[model samples]
Target chain A: MTADISLTPPDPKDFLDTDSLFDEEERLLRDTVRDFVRKEILPNIADWWEQGVFPVELAKTMGDMGLLGMHLEGYGCAGTSGTAYGLACLELEAGDSGIRSFVSVQGSLAMFPIWKFGSEEQKQEWLPRMAAGEVIGCFGLTEPDSGSDPASMRTHARRDGSDWIINGSKMWITNGNLAQVAIIWARTDEGINGFIVPTDTPGFEAHEIKHKASLRASVTSELSLDDVRVPDAYRLPGVSSMRGPLSCLNEARYGIAWGVVGAARACFEAALDYSLERQQFGKPIGSFQLTQRKLVEMMIAVNRGMLVAHHLGRRKDAGTLTPHQISFGKMDNTRNALEVARTARGILGGNGITLEYPVFRHMANLETVYTYEGTNEIHTLIMGQALTGIEAFS
Target chain B: MQVVVCVKQIPDPSGTYTLDPETHFLVRPDEQVLDDTDRYGVEMGLQIAQAHGGSVTLVSMGPKGSMQGIRQALAMGADRAVVVDDADLKGSDALTTAQVLAAAIQRTGFDLVITGTESTDGYSGVVPQMLAELLDVPALTYATEVEARDGKVTINRQTSAGYDVVEASLPAVVSVTAGVVEPRYPTFKGIMDAKKKEVEELTASDLGVDTSLRQRVTAVEPAPEREAGVKIEDDGEAHLKVVELLQQKKVI
Candidate 1:
């Protein structure tokens, strides 16, 4: 008897012709980010995840490619269309959610606040360098006890002569340990204010969070500020309420709505390849109806997630995107993506539990992604409030 | 020091491509990309122009959607682009392509012209020489490296034995081989700026060139498959088996 064994796996499954939806420029941007991921991230990601360390040099590489603050206008930003930015997020997250988080926190969380609300000096000082990736930044709005409810944060900023002294702690901060700057949101006498604190300051400390099973390839840290003082000019002069931080979260959540789709696609592709190559009971497992069902469900979820993301992206570019619409996208896409990842893992059998395959890693990463930047529960309530005009969140 | 780089849009080699069984011509998909080999020519042109204080202009002749390649070149820091797109240009041979490109390059007024050694799809290695003959410039093909200064150009041409150092006056044509220089990825800033860059489009009438197809593709067939070789696992007797097989083939 002759055995037919193939060394290479089958090509990835693309059930939906997604390219028809994007313009040429948007497709180019997605391809560029995808190429970068293939070259830079995919080869070393497994080891990085095993060690729980983010590659520090990727900041400069990504900065050189104009990924940091890619969607912002001026100050050395790429100023691409909103749809292009969403596509980039999708491709980056397809490599790993941690890589996408690094970009989202830089562009949407840190640089966005400075660009949207900071003083002219603040914008002039940080935006260009941040866009160039010479300086890395993180958003400090989530505290140990203030997650899901940001208005209850205990981090406070007090006025001391011409300087504002900030004392607070931010947990679950992506790129925190490696960031040179932190946009810390704290309660002030006027209301909640955002401070651009240099991490090298006298009282600023960032300790890496250890023993994390999810987002292991990313840098997550706890930031503690003890009387960190900066000039009054450092405060974002545009807004004085929690809306400042909330708006930034809205932008990040929009990226997440696209990013989780990438994660789900990665898992689905892995499962599809594994199923086709793996044989059981004298036949390839993918030929079975149950395996085909799993693949089809995953394909539909991935495509639907991307469709919602593209729709919201166009609305954002047209300036007609409402927060509630974004809430719907974030809630639906993340929940569906998490389910897809879990189902894909189930299809992979014992191999799904190992780091050698991307399915388990994405499944693990989506767990944290599901909870952060407006949890699925929080987004559902947000949509509920918008529809019923009743505050179910309280 | 004005430089012109010839570019083309081709199907991504990593993706599947099909040829029309009836026409025997390439049936391209909706997604077309800049040819990877041509990127070296664009990169070289940009670097030489930047170092010598001039602008790099891209000249291409393809279908309507071929602007994708020109835009990609522009995004890589080329100053502007000129696309000779016309319906009559369909099924044009390398000679016809060279004629159209020569006219466009003449209109653009270039001091130095660069092109890839060959298109990945055709690999004829004739267009650059044809373009040189049409433009009355010295042809420097298979250039591994090029340097221009003081109204003179030098090219390190690759050959079977080794390299050949060739020097030519200004107003010359050089076709670069792959790996002449590492092509840089277009930064997001570059992509944004490329949108505003000037793209001058011209047809055959505007370029004063004949676009009729002189050579036609009658049929296309896939390459013949190679026979499978025997695999001998290293089981201590593998070397003896290999010798026996070689002797059986009368090679030992």
Candidate 2:
């Protein structure tokens, strides 16, 4: 006899039971981070976004919850599974992409470099404090002149008396103003080098990028290094090429693959809620065929994005993840999420324009998400290069 | 100080609920979670144990699947847990549940027992008192605050007006009301570590408690819905109708 098959309808919230893919600890981690977001971040996020400020105090709170560098081992880090880290990112971004960006920059970009490539002394001196959020760190690589091509970066470091004096500027640096330490990448005689530069050093300056639009709740700044000198002991000795910074970027891109799913889910949820309650033509808007089509499309995209992100996370944990795979995930998920957000915005109509609902805010944030950490076009080319053995970059 | 927190796995309160007409009992969905109300007690137990230099152990009785909810308490920093799960223990009443829990607590041993005033799903509000009676300990209910020190426990018992300070010696049961302490979110490390923590599972026979339920839910009926409000249209002198209605209701 055949086993009984119970074909139940999918849960609207999790349409595919994609949640079951995660183990117990991973699910608990997601729920805990979700709870923290609901209680702490969601209530005050709109105000913070409007004021163009991120509450830096949240770093220590997240640190206490072991969210900072939570996936790393040793030095006060939580050492959670890779999928757990991805799930945490998903929940954090569900609140706001800016919040998840803060965590991604801290954990994947900042701490991962020191843990993966820094000297024993460097890790000993900085990892614990950074993990505790007692000290904040930022990664500096992209410059005003270089967005997609790091090989064209103008920032260079010259050796002088067993010390390095870096004199260049970095643009679009996250956590720049708040970081106590910075992982500054500079071109050198040895191809490229990573420096552990203290933000308090003389001649090193950070100016907050101000004015209109996207990721306003996040601290983006420009760093001007006018002969910022550091001892040789401050340098990461593990490698001397673009590999050092590229690896860090790769790690961050993995998190982004998972994070944007949250942004999409949030917008989708808001639209669904609005559609049900909002009345048009003497009935709920959700009852309309056109509105249902949008909702169904959103649901499919979110479920598909979650599957992609989770698959990438598993591959990463198994040590089989490739750069092209990361690019595929980041590019596809971000594009899908942005589309979902835009569709959700249209569903909300006039209310979608206001910050009272999260739809507009998410749409605005997804624009930055789509552009940063290897822009959609760059990632698309990277995927194209993988599929066909051809050099696409000029 | 050894503390035991009595917790239960219940249906997700936020989800849609239904009742079985034949059994006259609420149908439990496949999605079950740690009852939100029990977090207050778990937090209280953790706090007392942390402050007094002892470990907190969670004691629960439910289906074997209840481990999902039990691990949640463990993730909140409880040292370990004892879960009594038996197929025959299904449809247990408050007294039956108390008997099973009392046996588990006896086997686990506790200097103090902490529990919520009632579970969110089945709010009988009598399990803690029954468990206290079964264990032959002082039952302190509706405690807004509890302090265990010097081989005695003191509680700020919430009353209708304000609160009363009630004290009892060691080995007491304190059912904390919500807001006694804000439940802490489980840290990432705690969540991972909880997987490794020991959760000793037992059956009714293993705990050696009687499985016979003394109370039965005979019939269930939905409460009557509220009557629609009186809608008086404004015919320029609607204030007179409102005043007259209030006068009939003796409010004027």
Candidate 3:
């Protein structure tokens, strides 16, 4: 006896029916961001990647849409729930990881510190405009030698009469070249103090970094602060230790925990569609067992990563989320997303190497995402420390 | 002016949809999205309400899950919403749907009622007229442009030839086509605000409307697959073959 069998195409990336987990409003917020990405980012992303330039004007568009600092309250911010903000990150990263990074740097790194620790006068001066996207902002903390160990930063600030003079440099800063304000963290007599310095201040300069293989569509730059003097009032008075900057990094890392799932899902979808259409050996490549195994693995990783991100997001919204929980999610999701992207790239064969397919672009972007906002190794250590009552990094 | 817009929840047209083999009703997926055509009607209602200094209320009837579509309209700037979801309303025909909607509208009290030309799935094109008859108001169909002033409404209605300008008093029913106005995407702020917006739910008993099915579908069949056409090679006799095929079909 002979048997006949046929293979069916895979469904969308939401194999677990994840939409049921969110309320209608959360889903609507996600759909709105998804539509914006489909219309604005997806069409021009490949070209923007090829040219190695970020569209500076989209800041105004995003501001008009109330995406900047959307989770913050008052000062023209949307004051949405943290879960809604995570959904926005997921949708933004679905288009490209570079877009999500720009928003993360602006909202979490730059605006978050000011919102959380800045004095009322400083808030009145900058929060509304930053939320409006009329003024751009960047966070300067990582120096050339300080990637993970920010406590060893060489940047220093000294008191000069009524003014404070800051001198140092920051590397691998997103939105640096386009920012109008820089939140510079420097060592002071008290401790690590953060100063909100205007980028146009005398002796302040930012140069765009060239020849980047990852995150090419984003503006990454090196910031130079040479005797940049500002009034003492520009210093954030509420925070006096490295905890100030580390808190901001936690916020951005939380967003990244949700963002990488989007990148992985996009790559998996691209590979799945290509495999079903591209024929080989008198049948679709999807008919092969090896291709099916790769696709299934990619799908599971994307779905599981989203579940972790969503759980963490809800916890954050409920005000019960811990930094170590965020670290666990960030570590698992980014590593799994990078694996999914790499496996999907393999399924695409030679086509995966070209920009015509999104797998390669996302794979390259995940490398940067894997390292920034606390590296995979750093998060693993954090989890290790949480599990055991001992610190690993001496 | 108080504007009431009619919205419907339909299966995603982009996905594969089928009719129930036994009941002949649409097999709905777990998630039912708002119809694309209704978005234009909601946008038009919002624009008119904004200009005339009034509130826009959305009215819809479907399964309990249909509240998703109503919430989407509310997120797009509607003031509030009323959804009629009851098990007895299943498999309702166009006229029955109109009756339920008419009852719901009477409860809401509207100066102007707007609706899409047709639902994407049903495509009946008769609900607006039936609704106007039940509400005892003038019905303007296929409106491409709408304006309201001095308790009167003017609309440019699309027709086969071109468009015809029509005027009606306040308390009228107007059906807008898909391209009547560009719909705005709900901003993040709008989506958050919608969570606080009020959504009133009712059932068929509350509306006091009989939802007995008047039209029944006995069977459903898939559309016939189109056969591939024969390709004529570019030989010396290609023109002759084309003429012969056309002549055989009595075309010329």
Candidate 4:
């Protein structure tokens, strides 16, 4: 079973005030991305949302800053670890989920498939452009009818001489409309295979989905592929099953697990500020039991999520982690993040609904977090099956 | 070709400047920050190192209270950092402070020294030149552009007549103006790295930087506030007012 898009868990210390978890190099990347988010993303998020604009240049800019697929070693990547990716996501989502979705899809989703499974020529052709953000990539797994069950996806590619012809539609694709390249998963004669289809292909069209409030700062689109012909070389060589698509899902989902922690931290910290300085009854609302309980619950959620994410990250870097471990983090962190944001909203009273406070926005972003990758229900089943040694994706 | 960047922490200048109530000058318990313009200098040093295959050693001088800027600079990707902390050097003038940093760098043995045009608190912008003079190295000020080619550095100095691109061979002091390249941000790994980065700590006496031998700051006082200006209208009265004002000041 595939975890959702935000598959990787970001280390909470990147966004939260964890005493000191990052080494100097990691911290340098974290602060660099954070300041970039502040200077670049913060000022434009509202406008971007209002205009339904996903700044395509942002990929290039972040790529220039060593943000795209940062954990991957060499080939223009930062050669950092999972925690560095988490920190980057933390800083990214601290701005907006829409912006982070753009990165998550571009880096973990689109680029990793090629990096992990592509040929040397493919890597040479794609990694640098993807790394530099000059080329945008999108993961095409979710179809109109197959959000939870990707095995039933209708997208198909047939071997036609040296080229493979693809036909199907991908739905809910972040940066789908602006993708310079796409990792489109389609059922071939053998099984589900991955293809790197550039957006400029002969019969490819991307229509921006009108009216999205959740990931408003991102470009959520529907991809129409009609006889999209990519060379056999563009096909991810080792990919031959649902696992190929699922592996990419795992990658994206882990990032979301960490990214939402950023959203939660932003929410919790915002509430903490309002609680201390915001007053009623001649004392700070934070002095009250109700408010304190909310804050404590939020902190508890954040800490538990951090522990899971960080340890999972260390395990992943050490090559001892499994996809189920990723499921646990995505499930726990997103759920906790949603709860924390909801609780933080109540703390703000009236200001909670306004973008003036980030809680409401975080609350909305968490909605997308809950549903994507594997849904919370799907993750529970994956973990449940992993514990019992039984498959549950029936 | 290792370069050492010297940064000082000063309070935010946007707020009103005040003297210590007890000491009758300067704010005590002032928060530490990298000098606003010095970030450019640090960036310039990093660029040079990247170009020439060397490291940048970051040196910050202030009380122990100034560690945050050091960490912040490390987050911006300095190879290493050192802090020179001494109680006697807390309020030392620009020349004395540079004396201490110069001693620290001598121990570290950097090929070049980079500093901001001026610190926020000490706005003299003269430390790099003085340090260069003391170290017997060429000094370049108000560097708008810097390019390190092979073993040589060509710096564009910001002069009143636009900017002059001057080339220095090796081992020189370069002061930089702000807005050259936006300083890099601190990543999660960088924050973690900064913690493990050994901030070699030194005191004034440890560097043998004797403040007693330096020019004594016997009196430190706030500059008198400027009175609000009275505008003179365009007429004979304006000329007369200007003449009378100069006459009252015994000028002309």
Candidate 5:
């Protein structure tokens, strides 16, 4: 005979014990990143957001924590499991998307290209310091007119003896203002080639983009490469064409898929707290059926987004994750997070529009996250192409 | 020099707790974390070891399945850990805890022992002294700043007034109070490295120590509820009423 055993109820925050999917090490690492974000970022983020300044000093601290290039192997990188890195992204993004963007640009965009396709000399020179946050790097791929179509980028590199001279501008570059070196992808006589251009080069200038309503805490810049010259040693001797930049985008897009979950969770938690403390009709607003339904929706969306992120992270670790799947996660999770943030903002009523609560800030930040990496429309097309075998982009 | 830190894995203080009517013991929550008080001790031990060319070994006693606290301390840069876990050791008093810890520390062999002056859960504030007596070492309590040099340890011991500069020979036990030093958060590398670090588990029988309880709780009751404060309505003499209440409480 089997005796009756009582099952414990699910935690509303974790609801499904999604944490059980990770091992102890992953959880501990996640907690470490969470604590770091809580202690370092959360308290000061509002002021930073208001000032439109991302402290360049924190790059060193994050590098010290081994968060920079944390998923990559060798060169003083942490080489942690992909799931752990994604968990770190979740926690960091929970503080603010700008902080998470800082890490994503540093690790996936800037450092990843060097680690993946750079020469031994380049890797030896940059990876260790970049991983330690001593040197900051930014990717120069998106041009003023070229957002979705990198093949249409006007930045061109021409051979001058053994050296290559580049001329063009890249817009909306994260970490551009502070980058010591920039990985500028320019179309060459051969194909698209990536050049590691030092910022101190005579023709390299970065102008900070101002008046951003969303992602205000992040540094967005317009890079002018006016006859920037670099030696052949600086060119990444890897695959030519769009593959190099596309792979790096895939890496960052995967992180974005996980990062926005944190933004959504932050808004949901703020709304939940406000609902409980806010009183109307002689009781807390949370007592109402409509409010509870919104809460449940946010809770389900956050948890579902987390599960998708975890599943993709596991596949990435197993070396089986496909690009279309990443696009799927990025599109779905970003859309869901935006929806959750909007719903949470509605739940907060008048207070939602204010910066006093994180709801509005997260909602605003999710607006940018929705547009960057790959827009929801672009990702949908990627999914559509994968499903129906039709190349739709003109 | 070898510094061994005594850590306790207490139920997370932030979580709710309940009392067992049958046993008169506070039932532990499912979540366990390192005692906040003991962090200073562990940090001090790590600092001493880093400066003096040694390592910090963590020693803890808890239920058989609890390793979260020890793992956390290890992640904070402790070299290794020795945990004494056994079901038979339940309901062990302060003296019995001292015995089990003394036995385990003897095996670990420490040149210095560090612990919190008092645990957050058990406020007896007597374990360090008892452990020192059992180990036949001098006990220094309430250390806010610690320094080890020339085969000796020096501490700024907190007292009724300010603090006292106390010096003791090596092989002594030091109980650190909070705010000695800011504890460092574990880096990602440290967390991964902690998984590979050695954690030697032992039982009370393995330690060959007495597991007998020396004290029993005769009664258990909830703390008395505090009385509500007097509310003075403003009648253009609110300041005078506040002054009178303060005077009544001897605050002015």
Candidate 6:
């Protein structure tokens, strides 16, 4: 039976109501994902972290909820708008960067290339399976010897008739071992290109990265592809050079710009609420000047990051954004979010160090964040070069 | 079943929309989402469509801003949306708004229509019945259970006493209050699908509005001031005293 809609308009203040900026559909989707994250990911986040196991079920759950490839339109994707895509990242990362990383690897790194850069057959063969969570995808770029500088990687691919053989190793790959397909970045005769290398392919192996203190709930893997042969059709047609891998970075980094803010928000809100509720010296710690200052500072950072990401998102949607602009957002927001997480940990005192509180987990996750997706120094150099017309990285 | 759900975008309740000094009466459009009561109406429309294998077309009468409510309905799995937008329709009184909706209903050829018992802004409970009058259709107010089986609408109406179930034929209108079935939360995927759904827009002229009909808002503002309360200690004695006070005030 249909429930009577109380048209008595709710006091708009009751909901987040990001309606004007987003269409009704997008805003509602944002809220729905937000609510799901809050209910599903937040409560068990610490437990999963301390145990050194991601709620592996979380990925499948997210996929079941149609969170995977939320922005890629059609082809079994939710085909959400840019804002919805951003907000989903925000909510997911609010739980932990590791969980966010899993999604990033699966969507931007894996599914996106096949959809945007791969052949039609590749898209048809992979998209539905990826969308259904029947198959997972990961991107292989950062080599073991290379962290910030992927362009200098030694991974290479050679053509043999209708097949190409690849021999390379990728490090710091999220969802690596668990994924069915890996969009391996390798130096080909055509320069750096992408190949859809299945994890089950001959001479392909991915072992889960072990003993990681940061992003513990995330499944990080290192991949070794030795003489892994795939058909020529597996090559990404939309990409001919280094730009292919770099484009994936552009996508991941944009999500990180929004994702890290969620990290900061979780830390800041945790500190704010904890400080208010945790009593010290016969009053709430939030009543103390030092604590209040930290909270206020964190708030300023989070809010500022939100505003910056919002504009960057608008520019992206408007088709006016450039790689340099994206770098600026990623750099500024990740740095601020890392600082916020650290300070939030400080406010929590001894309790902050434990996985029981979100502060420490977020703080540790930000360490990985500060280094990934172009790195802090890389972004700075990109912006510097854009400003002065000088390539400082060289 | 061609079910039409009337929704309005109002202020976020938490915002406590303050009135604009110049225009009065919470001048800015309520931080808009689906009207709470009207959301139930939307769900009812969708439910009817789901069970009967028909289309649910969500409609709203307000400024273009009202499209948010329509989109929300669409995300709730409504098949389509119709938006009635116009400048003169701004701050429309209940009767004039009903006339506009009645005309739109005629154009759309609706089989069944559902609405909230009252709008949150003015809490005006006149719309559904007034709209029914304009359309010359049978209207049921405060419906609890609405069952459409074999060309008959069996409605259980909530009254001051309890409930009164009645049967009505096709082309009927109903208003529902709270205590209906639990409304479903908009799923993330549902919202994603809604973006692809079409939201067709209509205007006051399309609704065949009479400009002569009153559209005046001389003053609008927030509720009256609330007095400060005494700070009660979080102790057993204080708690007991609070309980006693509640009992004394007949609130227990």
Candidate whose DockQ is highest? 2
A1-394: candidate 2 lDDT, tens digit per residue: 9988768887888999998898777777888899899989999999999998988998888997899999899988999877888899999999999999999999999999999998889999999898888999999999999989987888889999999999999999999999999999999999899999999999899999998498878999999999999999999999899899999999899999999999999999999999999999999999999999999999999999999999999998999999999999999999999999999999999999999999888889999999999999999999888889886986
TM-score order, best first, reads 5, 2, 1, 3, 4, 6
TM-score top scorer: 5
TM-score of each: 0.90, 0.94, 0.88, 0.79, 0.94, 0.69
Candidate RMSDs in Å, in order, are 5.9, 2.5, 4.8, 8.1, 2.3, 8.7
Backbone clashes, candidate 6: 31
**Please, what are the lDDT tens digits per residue for candidate 5 over residues A246-341?**
999999999999999999999888988889999999999999999999999999999999999999999999999999999999999999999999
In model 2, the runs with Cα more than 4 Å from the true position are A1-6, B228-252
Please identify which of the two predictions, 2 or 6, would achieve the higher DockQ against the true structure: 2
Q: lDDT (0-100) at residue A88 of candidate 6?
A: 81
> First chain TM-score in every candidate?
0.96, 0.98, 0.97, 0.93, 0.98, 0.93
Clashes of each: 0, 0, 0, 52, 0, 31
Per-residue lDDT for B22-68 in model 2, tens only?
Answer: 76667775447788889999999989888989999999888747366
**Alpha-carbon deviation at B200 in model 6, angstroms:** 9.1
Question: Global CA lDDT of candidate 5, please?
Answer: 0.91
Interface DockQ of each model = 0.51, 0.76, 0.57, 0.25, 0.69, 0.31
Q: Which regions of candidate 4 fall more than 4 Å away from where they truly are?
A: A1-17, A22-24, A388-392, B1-4, B8-37, B47-59, B62-93, B103-113, B120-174, B186-208, B211-252
Segments in model 5 whose C-alpha atoms lie over 4 Å from true places:
A1-7, B29-31, B64-66, B218-237
lDDT of 2: 0.91
Model 4, residue A127: C-alpha shift (Å): 0.8
Global lDDT of each model?
A: 0.89, 0.91, 0.91, 0.81, 0.91, 0.81
